[model samples]
Target chain A: MTNENNSLAEKKTPPIYPVKTKVQVSIIFFVILGIYLFSMFWTQKEMVGGFSGAFENMFTVMEKFFPPNFGVIGAIWGPLVETIQMAIIATTIAAILTVPLAVLAARNVTTFKPLYYTTRTVLNILRTIPDLVLAVIFVGLFGIGLFPGILALVVFSLGILAKLISETIEAVDMNPLEAMRASGGNVYQVIWYALVPQVLPQFTSLVLYVFEINIRASVVLGFVGAGGIGLILNQQLGFYNYPNAMMIIVLIFAVVIIIEYISTKLREALI
Target chain B: METYSLPPKPKNSLYKKLKMIIITLLVIALYVWTFVSIDIDWGRAIERAANNFQRVIPKLFSPDWTATGEVALSMLETVFIAFAGSLMAAILAVPLAFLAAHNMMGGKIFSTIGKWILSAVRAFPDLILAILFVVAVGPNAFAGVLAIAIGSTGMLGKMFSEIIESIDMEVVQAMEANGANKIQILFYAVMPQIIPEFLSFAIYRFEVDIRASSILGIVGAGGIGTMIIFASNNRNWNEMGTILLAIIIVVTIIDFASSRIRNKIV
Candidate 1:
């Protein structure tokens, strides 16, 4: 190696990271890694058997999903429609609610530090609770139905939609907004005439993305007695109706694919 | 003064105007349809939710501190599940990412196939994966771990592949020019650059998994979710409040800690 590197080594300096802090960083990394390993060892009392075991279990379980019973699709119409409806309603409501929150949360728009940070922290708290947890809490409050599910979906999507739209708002060109303000425009006029035009397209796209998320999330919410196709799917799985479950999964896959394709095209058109 | 003559107003095409009107109408119709589909007694629902809040709000404000030890244990279990699962997924994702990365792999077909497979895996939500694992493993901490792993794998694989494809290829090319073997080239030229982002992503995923794993217990997958549901069943509002508070605190702490690390790394 010394013989091969002899010519260039003298002329070219070796690239190095910040070596002074390297040792400290390595120690912290190792300590964290050690803690994780220790915690996992303390927690696991079951057989994992690594990759080989995983493959075996996966294969055996997967075999039961073959030859999906398409016959059950007829009966699943109501719930499927119900799931779509839940997403539509919730997404529309969240999209509406997120507009104001996103503007308020955007640092450039709000200008006030306390208001901005508080909006961010509140958004974080809202996002940290996974949609399924929201559904669980809502379902607990009001028995299982589309109503609870819709409410959960609205709150869940609101947090994310607001966050994304706020970032978009922050990134908009500021000159127009500045011009409006310089002309003595009120806050509402500045937002409507200057800010709205720039942010509208991105807002619509984010809404679409949120809707896509809601569809997938609604399915999971159904597992916990919130109304949707997932609820039916869970019931089938609980009953050990593998063939029926397979059909529902297939239907969901198809719907998700179609919706994603359309949304992607629409987003491409917007951007 | 420049616009004193009143510049011609921008013309609005009739087609565009009609299209906008139609789109607005369609949006309204869709909203109406969604409302009709989810039939609700709104007045009753508002009354009921308000009443429930009256009973639940106080407990939420004053969490029952007695269950701190139990809450701590469950929180630990949640952290372990996220850590082990995300680590496992990160390790497994490396090879799949190599296959999917367009820069490393010349064959387009295989990369596309890899992408499609990842997307299919992604479509299956984490909870469903947990439910599937629970069916096989009889519901435990391990099942939750496995579920998180599978879900993380889908996302991590795609993200890692994108990272791999976007990396500066000059170093790798230089290593190739030096007649290094494939493994040596990857380890020497690529691994150094990719590790930081990979670590950042894994930590981010772990934070999300902690929140996710808590709810896995609702389906008997193991976490604090079962406690919340249990307290609700028993009408022990205070205990439920305590668990929710515990989750929020732990989640906030993890988010704060991880974001700091991620910022330093990236």
Candidate 2:
């Protein structure tokens, strides 16, 4: 390499690549990699059956779930509808509530530094709480019913919806809002006529996306007696009714796939 | 000639105005119907909502500090499970990702099959996957690990395949022209380009798996989620507050720390 660059040496040839930086980069990489590998090894040793044992167990388990009991589907229809209803109601509330919070949280919309920081911090903490814990807490608070499930879904989806909408607001082509303001439009008029149009598409798309998340979340919330299809599934499991549990799983799976398909199509159309 | 001044805004046409009102009404009706259909004790819920605020928020400030040790240990267990799961997914997803990518797979049938499998696996959420594993392995942390790995595979494989499909074909063509073997081309051409992105995706999945494994406990698969259930069951709102606070703190710390590391890599 030195020989090839000799002719340009007197003219101050730059190094082809920064050897110093490359070494530093790899050193950092290896250190992180080392910690990650050690953690994996420790966890594997502490838990999990061996690979061969798991394979054997997997096969045995396969037999238990085979030809899943479809008979239980009829019994679960009411609870399944309850789960869907929980998602729909929660999503509507979250979408409606996100409008003001998202606007205030957005740096572009709110120049109040303290407000942005406070809102951001609160949202982060909200997002950090696992949805399961939220469900369990709500269940305990309000007693077991669809209300707690709906409430949990509201808070859970709010964290997601607010974050997404705020980012969307920030990324909007600021020109339209600016144009309206320049035209002497009041704040409400500017937002409604200019900013709303720009973000309407994404806002709708994100609401549909959050609705999908809420459906799955509501099912899990039911496991903790929060009230939905998962409650029945958990009851069956606790009673050692594998076939019934299998049936519930299948029904939920079908619903998830159908919802996912519809949402995907809707999202694509929005774009 | 004087420049024309901006015209006053025109009112929305009656048809458009009526259409807007109809849409708004329809949405409100749907929301109301969904709310009313559920069998809920709204009176109790509203009553408890106020009681819960009085009962819960105060406890959060005085978090039962004694439970911190137990909570932290289980939080570590959750992180360990997530680590193991993410690594497993990273290893398991590569070949499947290659098979799924149309640009790499070459055959429509193979890629279609791969895509279908990914979609099927992705349909089940981690908590549901945890339930299946609990039944399989009798509710150990290992079950949580397996569940997380399987869940992560579906997503990581799909994202990986997408990245592979969008990669520059020119480098691959050059390598093939040089008479490189399949493995040689994969390593010398494809791997170099996608490795950074794959790492980022895997790391991101690990962060997500941490949040997921914590909740896997509700179904008896493993982790701190069971702590919340237990605390709630015993009507120990203070203990529940402690558990929740621990989770929030731990998860936020990890999110920030991991994101910083990610920035260095990508």
Best-fitting candidate, measured by TM-score?
1
TM (chain A) per model: 0.86, 0.87
Candidate 2 residues A40-150, lDDT tens each?
665456445665777788778878777688887788999998888989989989999999999889999889999999999999888988777888877767877888788
lDDT tens digits, residues B69-173, model 1? 887788778878888888888888888888888888889988998888887877787887887787666567778888989988988998999999888999999
Query: Taking the tens digit of each residue's C-alpha lDDT, what string does model 2 give over B56-101?
Result: 6677566788888998888887887888889889888998998899
The list of candidate 2 runs beyond 4 A from truth reads A1-51, B1-33, B49-55, B177-179
Give lDDT: candidate 2, residue A56: 81
- For each prediction in turn, the share of the native Cα contacts (below 8 Å between chains A and B) that it retains comes to 0.44, 0.60
The candidate that wins on lDDT is 2
Q: Per-model C-alpha lDDT, please?
A: 0.83, 0.84
| Model 1 chain B lowest lDDT segment of ten | B1-10
TM-score of chain A of 2: 0.87
Deviating ranges (above 4 Å) for candidate 1: A1-33, A46-58, A183-189, B1-29, B170-181
Error of 2 at B194 (Å): 1.4
lDDT of 1 at B264: 91
